[model samples]
Target: MTSDLRLSRFEYGFAQFMSVMASAPAKLEEKPKERTHQTRDRSREPHSRSMPFRNEMGSEMVDIYVGPEEEPFRVHKQKLCRRIPYFDKMFNGQFKEASENVGRLPEDDPAAFDVLME
Candidate 1:
């Protein structure tokens, strides 16, 4: 009688454990439903414009010139001023280069500037 009672209890516990294990996989596999109010139209949004500055000469308004005499890069002042802190200070602050609109970087490599421009 005692053995039968213990066996019944063990069987009941095993059945409950197996039921939970079976349902866990189903719950994990189910995909979450998307919210109805979260519809967004990404295609209608306006794309950004291309860079106005280029490597070519006389293409656009050249605000500042950089690098050595042999290999100089013509870059936009507004773009540089906005992007680089060093350039912003030099161009905006009361300096000789601010008025001249020409910044010479003899020590700095021109290839680096080319990469930056690109």
Candidate 2:
């Protein structure tokens, strides 16, 4: 037989073998394993939540001076970013405010900023 004919026969045999293997049923183990430890009730367990305002003291804070009065306010950078996209960009983006950790808003009302921070 020629090399091409031999190769074709081998390929046909391989394909048939693969098809048979693919069609075979999967076998399960005869024995089952037991749990090593007891499962505890997770609902009763104490868990820490994202209480940003309550836990702000531990995190990094940013100083913001707003309005013509330049009324100063301090806020947690992370919590501020989470609620305000403008602050997020200003504090995270390649701006002077980001590096300084300080923001000045001469045009914005301090009362409005206070409401937002609260």
Candidate 3:
């Protein structure tokens, strides 16, 4: 039983990857492969109208464009801002998006934005 309880490193790694993939945002209807590949790493990249961020749960969290620490990055809220062409009408306000989620209100919602700051 104890032997069975342990998983090999490969198995562990595979499981971790699967979990990450499952959580990471994914496209619903497939698109041209080029576009799909380009936006894969949405978190740690520079700002672009093209970039989008979702968590390990296949939901849109934020549209991020990573930069430097001082000009560190630009994080955009979705509901107020425009959604990507393909992904529009998919998620509700602040749903299936960034890990930094908040209430179903506009980005300028004082309480919701406050939560995001923390």
Separately for all candidates shown, the number of backbone clashes (residues 3 or more apart, or on different chains) is: 0, 0, 12
lDDT by residue (tens digit), candidate 2, 31-114:
446759988677765556445545764488899998899999998898876655566777887899999999988866666566
Models sorted by lDDT, best on top: 2, 1, 3
**Cα-lDDT of candidate 3:** 0.36
TM-score for candidate 3, please give it: 0.21
RMSD in order of candidates:
27.9, 25.1, 16.9
List candidate 1 segments past 4 Å from native: 1-70
TM-score: model 1 vs. ground truth: 0.44
Q: Best candidate, TM-score-wise?
A: 2
Least lDDT summed over 10 consecutive residues: which range in candidate 1? Answer: 49-58
TM-scores of the candidates in the order shown: 0.44, 0.52, 0.21
User: Where is model 3 more than 4 Å wrong at Cα?
Assistant: 1-3, 26-118
Which sections of candidate 2 miss by over 4 Å?
1-58
Reference-based lDDT, residue 45, model 1: 59
lDDT of each: 0.55, 0.67, 0.36
In candidate 1, the residue pairs with backbone N, CA or C atoms under 3 Å apart (3 or more residues apart, or in different chains) clash, namely none
Candidate 3 RMSD to the real structure: 16.9
